[model samples]
Target: MKKTKILFYDMKDYDIEFFTKYGKNYNFEMKFLKVKLSEETAYLSRGFDVVSAFTNDDINKNTIDILAKNNIKLLAMRCAGFNNVSLKDIKNRFQVVRVPAYSPYSIAEYTVAMILAVNRKVHKAYIRTREGNFSINGLMGFDLYNKTVGIIGAGKIAQILIKILKGFGTNIIAYDPYPNYEIAKELGFEFVDLDTIYEKSDIISLNCPLTKDTKYMINRTSINKMKDGVILVNTGRGMLIDSVDLVEGLKDKKIGAAALDVYEEEEEYFFEDKSSQVIQDDILGRLLSFHNVLITSHQAFFTKEAVEAITVTTLENIKDFIENKPLKNIVPQDNN
Candidate 1:
C-alpha cells in the first residue's frame, strides 16, 4: 500500500516534529513547505493527499481552486480561529478541519496579563526600573476587586477568564448570544444585553469570533455607550473591534487604556519584522504612539502547550480525512 502524502505549509520546528512522529505511526509521508500559502505557492501541495496550513497563510478561493485542481481533498488548520480562510468559497472544494480548542488557558492567561500590565502600568515600571529610576509617583493603580468586568462571547477562553477573574472578587457580566447557562450559574455571572455591559463595565474584553454580524461590533456608536475612561482589551478576532473607532475613543478620553493582541490590518505585517523599513500603515503607526495602548503580535496562543495541542490536532485531522473517519473539528458551512 502506498503511504498518504501530507504537505504542511508555513510550519515551524515543532509542527514538523509532531507530524513526523505521529504520521509515521499511520504510514503517512510528510513534506514541509516554508513559504506562505498563496496562489503561487499552492502548487507545493501538488500530488499530496492533504495540505496543512498555519494561522498566517492565505487559503482563499484561488488557492483552494488550485489545490482542488491538483486533487488535494483536505485543508487542515493548526489554529483554533478559521477567519483567515475563505469558508464560503472553499466549502465544496475541500473538507476543512481545524483545532477548535487548543489551550484556552494560554489565551485567557495572556488576556489577564495584558489587563494587569495596562491597569498597574507594569510595562512602564519594568522599563523604568531597568533605567535605575525607582520613583513610584505615576505607578498608582486601582484594585481589581469589586470592579465590574464585561466579557463578550462566553466561549471556552471567556469561561477560563471568568474563572480566574472570580478569584480576584470582580463582578463579572457577560454578553453572548448563545450563553452557556451551566457555566454562568456556576460562576455567578450575569448574562445581560450588550448595551448593559457597555454601560456598567469598568473593563471590557472581547473574546468572540469574527462573523458577518460580529465584524466591527465595537464601533463608534457602541463606544459612546461605554463609561468614561473604561479599559478595553481584545484577544479575539481583530475585525471585531473597529480600529478607527478605538483610536477616536482613546483620543476623546472615552477609553482609559487598551491592550490588543490582534489588529484589523494585521495581514500585511504581523509575524514579520519590518523595524528597519518604514511602516506604511498610518493607523498602526498612530496606535503605537499612544502610551495608554499596548499592542502585541497576536501571540496569546504562542505557549508550548497550545503549540503542541495545535500540531497534534492538525495531524489527527489529516489522519481522520485519509482514514474516512469523522473529524472532531470539522468546520461546517452552515452553523445550523
Candidate 2:
C-alpha cells in the first residue's frame, strides 16, 4: 500500500497551500517545483509516478518523450487548456487528463468584469480620482443596454456569459463550430457566422479553444472586418488574437478598447512578478503603452472555488488511474 508520488510543475504559493491541504485526505506524496515542465525539466520526473502541469508549461514532443523515458505514467493538467501539450505525441507515451470544467462561472464572471471595466474606463477613473483630479474629463462611457454583443465559441463559459449579458438588455449573437440551436433558443441568443459576428457586434468576446485553424484567428484581415471602434475582450487563449495585429487595430482606431487576460508568450512572465525587470517582449511593451488596453495576468480561473475543485478533481483523476477506473477527463488526441 505505497502512496502515489505526484510531481507538480510551475507551483505557485496558492497551489502549494491548497494542494497540501487537500493532499492530506488522500494517501499521496506530492512534490512541488517552481520551474515549468519542459524538455529540460522532464528528467526530474524519473522517480515520480505522475507529472502535473499548468497552463503555461511547455509539453511538446521532446518533453513527452522525456517523460515517457522517465517512467511517468500519467500527465495531469491542473487547468482546462491542453493547447500547451503535444497531444499526438502523448497518445501512446502516457495518458493525459485535465480539469475541463473546474468553474465555468469563475471565467464567465471575470469576462464580464473585464468588459465592464474597459467599457466604463473604471481603471482610468480610479487613477484619476486617486490623484484628486476628478473632473470627469474624457471619462465618458456608454450603456451596455441595447448593445450588440457577439460571442465566439458557445461553450459553457460562453453560455454563462451570454446569460449574464442578457440581463443587461443587450442583443447576443454567437458563433460556434457545433451550433446548438436548442441552447441558443433557451439562452435567448442567435448563432451566427464569424463574418456576422465581426460586422454586427459592438463588443466581441473570444471564448474559444486554440487550434490549428484558430491560431492567430484575430489577425489584420479579421480586424479589417470588425466594426470600427469595436470593444474586444479575450479571456480565452491568448494566441487567439495576434498582439501585433491588435496593436495596429488600436492605433487605427478600428478597435476602440481591448481587455486581455492571457498573452501568447506569457510563460516567462505571467505568473511570476517582473516588476523590477524591464519587459523584453516588444509587442507586450507596445500593448501596455496604449491607454485603452487592459491587460491582466492569467487569473480568470483563479478563484477559491475553482482552485479547490481543480485540486479535488485532479486527485480523483490520479486515484482513478491508480485503481484502473475509466478516466472521465482524458484528453482526446487530434481535436485540434
Candidate 3:
C-alpha cells in the first residue's frame, strides 16, 4: 500500500524537521508549504490526500470550497485551536481533526512566567540592568502568598497552573461553564461564577478557549468590575480581551499590569519580524506605549515537549483519517 501524501501549510523549520522525522515511522509523505493557507493557495494541495494547517491559517468556507474542489479529503490541524476553520462548511465535505491536547505544562508554565514577569517587573529590570542602571528604585513587586488568582478556564492547562499556583499558597477561584468538579476537588480550587471571579481575584488569568461567549469578554464593563490595580495576564486566544478596552483599562490604572502572549488583530503582525517597520495598528501602538504592559510573540506553546506532542498528535490524527479509525481529536462544529 502506498503512503498517504499530506500537504502541510505554514511550515516552520521546526515543523518540517519534526514532521519529516516522525512521519517516516508512520508511512506518510509530507510536502511542506510555507505560505499561509487561503482560498487562492488551496490549489497548491491538489492531488494530495490530506492538508495540514496551523492556527493562523485562513480556513473559511471559500478556502474549504477550493480545497474540496482540489480533492482534499482531510484537514489535520497541527494546533489545538480550530477557530479559524469553517466547521459548518466542512461538516460532511471533509473530515477535520486537531491536536486537542499538547503538553499543557508548556502553556501552564508560561502563564506563571508571565504573571511573575509582569508583577516583579522582570522585563523592565532586565533592560535597565543591561544598561548598567542597577537601581531598584522603581522596581516593586508584591507577595504571591495569600493572593487571590481567578482563572477563567478550568481545563488541562488551567488545572496545571492551579497546581503550580497552589504551591505559592494563593487562593484559586475558577469559572467554567462545564466545571469538572472532580478536578476542582482534587486540585483544591473553588468554582465560582463569572461575577465573583471578576470582583474577587487580585490577579486574573485567561486560559479559556475563544468562543461566542468569550469573544471580547474582557471588555470595559468586565474591567470595571475588577479590583482596582488588578493584574491581568492572557495566554489564551487574543480576542478574549478587547485591545481597545484593555488600553483604556491600562490608561485608567484599572488594570495595574498586563502581560499578553496573544493579541487581538495579531494575525497581521505576530509571528513576523517587523522590527524596522512602524507598528500601524493604533490599538497595538497604544498598548506598547504603556509602561506596565508586556507583550510576547505568541510563544507559550513553543516548548520542545509541546512541539513534539503537537507533531505526534497531528500525525496520529492524519493516520486515523487515512486508516478510517475513530479520531480522538475530532473537534465539534461549535464549542458551544
Candidate with maximal lDDT:
2
- Candidate 3, residues 289-313, lDDT tens digits: the string is 8879999999999998999999999
TM-score of each: 0.94, 0.97, 0.96
Score each candidate by Cα lDDT.
0.88, 0.94, 0.92
Regarding TM-score, does 2 or 3 come out ahead? Answer: 2
lDDT of 1 at 137: 85
**What residue runs in model 2 are displaced by over 4 Å at the alpha carbon?**
334-336
Quote model 3's TM-score.
0.96
Worst 10 residues of 2 by lDDT: 327-336
Which one wins by lDDT: 1 or 3? Answer: 3
Candidate 3 overall lDDT versus native: 0.92
Per model, how many backbone clashes are there? Answer: 0, 0, 0
Estimate, for each residue in 196-295, the C-alpha lDDT of model 2 and write its tens digit. Answer: 9999999999999998888999999999999999999999999999999999999999999999999899888899999999999999999989999999
Which residue pairs show collisions in model 1? none
